[model samples]
Target: MKRLLLFPVVCLLLQFSYAQSRDEAAVTQAVENLRKAMVDGDKAALEKVSDDKLSYGHSNGNLEDKATFVGNIVSGKSDFVKIDLSGQTITIVGNTAIVRHVLDAETNDGGKPGTVHLRVLLVWAKEGGQWKLLARQAVKEPVK
Candidate 1:
């Protein structure tokens, strides 16, 4: 009787492990999609991947909602010339994921060009069976 009960518990644990892996992979893909959409200025893709209540915080203490973020990027006001991410890690908890990465980018926002190196944290949630970016915060890294 004890062995039989243990078997079901083991099976459930294994199933949960598998589901977690799959969800992690999906969230990772969503992060990549967001980067591509930003560079390509694909508003449709941005809208698709971002939650309606997105809170995008910049390194310079600026904040934007989903509409403003997509609009600025798509309208050449917040243009990203290139973005390279390093030291990326993703952690999944139930229906939410937390992603951390070092971001290096060349940006041309409002006709002013600059390069930025920052540490970024992103929160993603599974909504309607899809991963969507829910919040983001970036902090400028000290010069090395």
Candidate 2:
């Protein structure tokens, strides 16, 4: 009797284990679009993904507000390239979500070509039924 009750519960949980939402495919699509936007440096997409009061922390320890962060990309200052990436984990809880993504990026680094393997933690909050990024922090790990 105990095993019979446990089996259905286990199966039900497995069905929704992917993420906090039933529509995980939409979240994946949203993340992919954001990556493309960051790589191509489309200011519009950047703005769409972020909240008005966004806090951005760079891998180099520089911090910028949402406006400054978007402006830098629009002005051609910090550019993204070679954005090879892997599994992105997104967790939605109530009205907030956190996305963890691992990316291998090649950058001009303001005239010096550099490559970095980093994980980005992006905090998102659902405001007016739309997910907006509240904060983003990127940390680089030395790859062997």
Candidate 3:
């Protein structure tokens, strides 16, 4: 009886771990893609990473829709460079995952390199079997 119970417990643990791994990979990749896109200034990449009607709340309290965000990058209004994720935590609960990435980044607006220490909350949803960013809210954490 003890062996049987232990076996089921082990199997259940493996199943849960596997499920979590899948979700983790999907959302982590999405955020990584976004970072790369921002650094490369590739507006086209947003087509896959972001939803059509996405809401973006910036650290500076600016709100921008999908079109505006992409347009700004493509039109030379915004530029990001040397983007590096310092400590990132991604968690998935059902179909929703909140990704927090604290990084050092360089922006054209004369911000400290990665010292921006942005605490970004990225919301991703599974749509048609692929995960895409539905919303993002961020706050600039003070440098410690």
Best by lDDT: 1
Residues 1-144, candidate 1: write the lDDT tens digits: 999999999999999999988998898899999999998999999999999999999999999999999999999899998999999999999889999999999999888999989999999999988999999999999877
TM-score of model 3 vs. true structure:
0.85
Q: Which candidate has the top score in TM-score?
A: 1
Using TM-score, rank the candidates from best to worst. 1, 3, 2
TM-score of each: 0.94, 0.78, 0.85
Q: Assess candidate 3 and give its lDDT.
A: 0.82
Clashing pairs in 1: none
Tens-place lDDT digits, model 2, residues 42-128: 999989987899999998899999889888776657777768777788777767777898888887756667888888898877787
The residue pairs that clash in candidate 2, if any, are none
Q: What is the lDDT of residue 34 in candidate 1?
A: 96
Cα lDDT computed for each candidate against the true fold:
0.95, 0.79, 0.82
Worst 10 residues of 2 by lDDT: 18-27
Q: Which stretches of candidate 3 lie over 4 Å from their true place?
A: 109-115
Give stretches of model 2 more than 4 Å off. 1-19, 142-144
**Candidate 2 backbone clash number:** 0
- Residue-wise C-alpha lDDT for candidate 3, range 1-29, written one tens digit per residue: 99988998999999999999988997888
